[model samples]
Target: MIEGALGDLRNGVSRIAHNEKIEELQSEFSGDKPHLQHSKPLHLDPMFYEALDVLHYVEPTCLAAFLKLSQFMHRVEDVPNTKAYMESDRIIKWPPNRW
Candidate 1:
């Protein structure tokens, strides 16, 4: 019975979180103005706290939310940036030399 109740609670919270993210994304991308110019600064403290909680508690909903948030924050690959690193004389040892 307790397990079922917890499952239901998790499902409900997940739905709410998913809906909120949808709303936020819609509002962020709907306007005619540039997203970066008008959008509010993102606060990352709560995200960090949620990540820590997920790490400690191992909750499914929190973990899913964290993963989704991480996906949203993902950046595209930069070829130029990688080129600079590749051209640099940085010696990288395979086993990393156990310290």
Candidate 2:
């Protein structure tokens, strides 16, 4: 009985953590302005949804997977501009150039 109860608690925590990840992923692709994310609805990408399907099933509380996917999503989102920034060495510039 105690084992069953512990299992329930673990599942609950897992769902909550997964929910947070979903919300985070949603927020990642939400709006034009980063500051406007809160006002927008989720705009998750197909890749995110696909990855979620695989990860959530394997381990609902898989933080490591979430982080990896999150990082990839961030990179994917920034590719166009980020590529230029990287080639320009701005990413490594100390006292980052004034806008």
lDDT string, candidate 2, 30-80, tens digits: 534432233321344433433443445557566465554555445544556
**Ten-residue region with minimum lDDT total, candidate 1:** 70-79
TM-scores, in order shown? 0.22, 0.25
Query: What's the true lDDT of residue 34 in model 1?
Result: 22
lDDT of each: 0.40, 0.48
Give the deviation of candidate 2 from the true structure as CA RMSD.
Answer: 13.2
Worst 10 residues of 2 by lDDT: 33-42
Model number with the top TM-score: 2
Candidate 1 lDDT by residue in tens digits, 3-98: 886676566446545564643553356343322223332344234333333333434444354443443333111234534554678734232212
- Going through the candidates in the order shown, the clash numbers are 0, 0
